[model samples]
Target: MTSRANRSRNNRCATALLVATTLVLAACKAQAPTPQPEPATPQVTADTSAQPARSTDAPLPSEDASLAPAVTTPALPSAFVDKVWKVSKSGAVEPGTTYVFLADGTLVIDSPNGTPMHGRWSFDKGALVMVEEGISYPTEIIAIDDSQFHIRSHNPGEPVDIELVPAPDQPLPKP
Candidate 1:
């Protein structure tokens, strides 16, 4: 009788120890960090100045630029203002229209049909606003580089999104 009781007690102790070890192992595994995949490196192309343009499928006025406080002299990107940009796709401006952003904050738009349109452009806090004639266009610069200048104009009735590419070297417009 005594031997049988001793054997039963020993078996229960061993089973309890096994259960505790398994629980601890499970808890540790739950807390372990998972391995993450490494990021792929960017490929270099012949035209290093060019980058893929963003999709303009979405409607304009993604963000309100009017709420942004006015700036005295908005700092425009040197690369964007340096070259003339030709419009490829737009809702407001005609296709093939050329744009020149001067260092003195002059925005010149040369439409194929009419005379050059003069406007004042400013960029501050990622908000670009252009004033021409008597209308204000709050513009969002989607992307700008040496090769491309894409923007979305927040015109009240019909918001215009435009894609522009670097045009051939041309003479700077008169101030």
Candidate 2:
């Protein structure tokens, strides 16, 4: 009789413990998770009108214009102005190459071979044109943001997607 009493008590304790654990788990599962807010996206619009032809001798806008509180110039996006961009991938140009678009229409390219090439750059119809030695090479800006840009070369061949990233090491040209 004593042994039977002890066995009954142990069974009851085990059942109680199992019930408590199940109730605790159920309470945890009943609680709702907090909702997360969606990320805000920047608004961007495209201009389809024809732009006036810019002369190679004509200088670009000042750097202050890009940083101004209001939008004044429509020639180039503010993100592209006064930025040192590095070619992440390209067929014609080698990777790890750096390019700087100055506020004075000067395009400086530092190749991996340590050769620095100087050219004139301009933005027309969502495309960036770089002219060197009277030869014009235009690249279409597929997408651009504050940090990076995607460009497609107009050269006839295997169309390679070129990604340009902000080069913090390369400083922007003085205004």
Candidate 3:
């Protein structure tokens, strides 16, 4: 009777050991080596939703860069790069918002999806203003640059400053 009980106990111990070994093996297989990224390339397309592509034509992260500076102001219209900019923490762009600008002093921004906000943009004598449609007052453009801008209203409220940055997979400037 003693021998029979000892044999049953040994069987249970062996089964527990087997289960533990199996669990250890599974854990080892769960971890995998991470893959490395390839070399950087150049020549990316213009996209506002994503960052610029990795390319040789693009500037490196260590390169000296500035979004906007006090000096070296650029002229409007010609300097503005027409693209779909993501409105971060700004007022609604309205439904079906389509921004169209012509070189001949004609500008239109319409909302196609929701209520439309109509406004005409014009720059003169180093001043910028948007008026008409539903806006109560004119919106003044304080300053604009490659990656940042400042806009203020005539009524003396907090000036809204925005930074325009390249989206991921965006087109990089030609080197």
Candidate 4:
């Protein structure tokens, strides 16, 4: 009887230790720094009508690195990238949602449901384009300041505007 009681206590101690170790590992992973992604190559289309047709034997334009045009991606506003934004008003996204725009074009969104969504973002012709789950959302920056941001999404058939303010930073959960 005493041996059985000892085994039961030992099993509980082992289970608690395993759970604690798992929580500690999860916290460390959550705090790990994200790796920066490689820059994307810009797509350039040449006008074939202006130049004479070439035979199959001819070298492709990509064969000569000098011929490639220099294209630079416009940088996102410093105010937008510098802070975590929380949704104060929006018809599309729920209020209290948070957003973090990393300089490496990574967009992190946390909704009220506690699920975090990841997406890619880029700038085109002074407009913001966010790609999530393979769908692109072209957005316009209506206004932005140190403490506030406003944007209008031009999703075909479903246009909406959003207002955001700086959100207080939330610390990672501890074990």
Candidate 5:
């Protein structure tokens, strides 16, 4: 009967399916696991934008360069807090990032549209330290002074120094 023939055909099909699954599992077990790629090392670039051009006639701060007491924290005044400051960094002119300083003391930084994108920044050793994040040309620019930020990208080549002048009435970093 046709029903008997169909039952036999289905059994054969079921056996074929089981065999196929077993072979797939065996093949998967035979293959070795792929290794993950190592993370790329960070390339340090010298950003001289923070670098000051000490005038030959300019006098130094003090005869004794002493370190501040660890207990004493010299605070950046709240007068500039919760305000936006326009930054020209790493040899680049205006149209830079606007850092909004909040009262609680966090920073909200806006990225530059046209210029090279600098990375994340935090105050380190009294100056701003920037690490290249999600940027096309990964650059780590450090703040040298109020007007200068500098860094050179070893990966991309060519050291870049940026000069940043604070735009008047710019909001301070967010709290």
Candidate 6:
């Protein structure tokens, strides 16, 4: 009878030890996950009413040699390259204003004042992104062809539809 009692006590102690071990293992495994960095928010100014000062001789966006290899600029479509397009109709840009998109991703906006506005241009995420004087405008390309290009501004209040026709003398870039 004493041996039976000792066996029962030993079994209880073994079960308690197993349970304690399992609890300790579970506590160690249940850790808070490491935090991840947030995505960068683009810096945009609120003064959308004022026109940015044109800088014809402005240097291109600086490219660091070390970072250039990792950073790849999405190429503009071949059909839109090296062409001078004029605004046939638009509320954003003055009608008859010419915009030249060079193959090297340089955008030349011939302002109504006749001063050329130089800026960097790139096609990103299915939108044509134009950055001028630190302001970035991502406009949706409605359609494009050898003859005409249509674009819609992302502005909510003053939404603009710009129609662009190729310059008479300028021809489409060779594929």
TM-score of 2: 0.51
Instruction: For candidate 6, list the clashing residue pairs, or say none.
Output: none
Clash totals for all candidate models: 0, 0, 20, 0, 37, 0
- Per-residue lDDT tens digits of candidate 3, residues 61-89? 46736522332333455555344333333
- The best candidate by TM-score is 1
Q: Across residues 26-93, which tens digit of lDDT does each residue of candidate 4 receive?
A: 88776657888989899899534212224778566699777442211232457577368889999888
Model 6 lDDT tens row, 54-167: 254754345434422211222236766688898998877898788777778787878667877788778755457777766777776666767777776665477578889888
- Candidate with the larger TM-score of 4 and 5: 4
Candidate 2 stretches with Cα past 4 Å from truth are 1-75, 156-160, 173-175
Each candidate structure's TM-score, on Cα atoms with residue i matched to residue i, is 0.55, 0.51, 0.37, 0.52, 0.31, 0.50
**Whole-model lDDT, model 5:** 0.48
lDDT of each candidate versus the true structure = 0.73, 0.70, 0.47, 0.71, 0.48, 0.68
Return the candidate ranking by TM-score, descending: 1, 4, 2, 6, 3, 5
Candidate closer to the true structure by lDDT (higher is better), 2 or 3: 2
lDDT per residue as tens, model 1, 1-175: 9999999999999999999999998887766577888898897665311222334673433465553322112324675774688998876678888888888988898988989999888766646778888687887666665667777777888778899988876667886
lDDT of 3 at 87: 32
lDDT of 3 at 95: 28
RMSD (Å) of each candidate, 1 decimal:
13.2, 16.2, 18.4, 28.6, 20.0, 15.0
Minimal lDDT window, size 10, model 6:
67-76
Query: For residues 49-97, what per-residue lDDT tens digits would candidate 2 score against the true structure?
Result: 3232345574555643653322222336566767889998776778888
What's the residue-level lDDT of 171 in candidate 5? Answer: 38
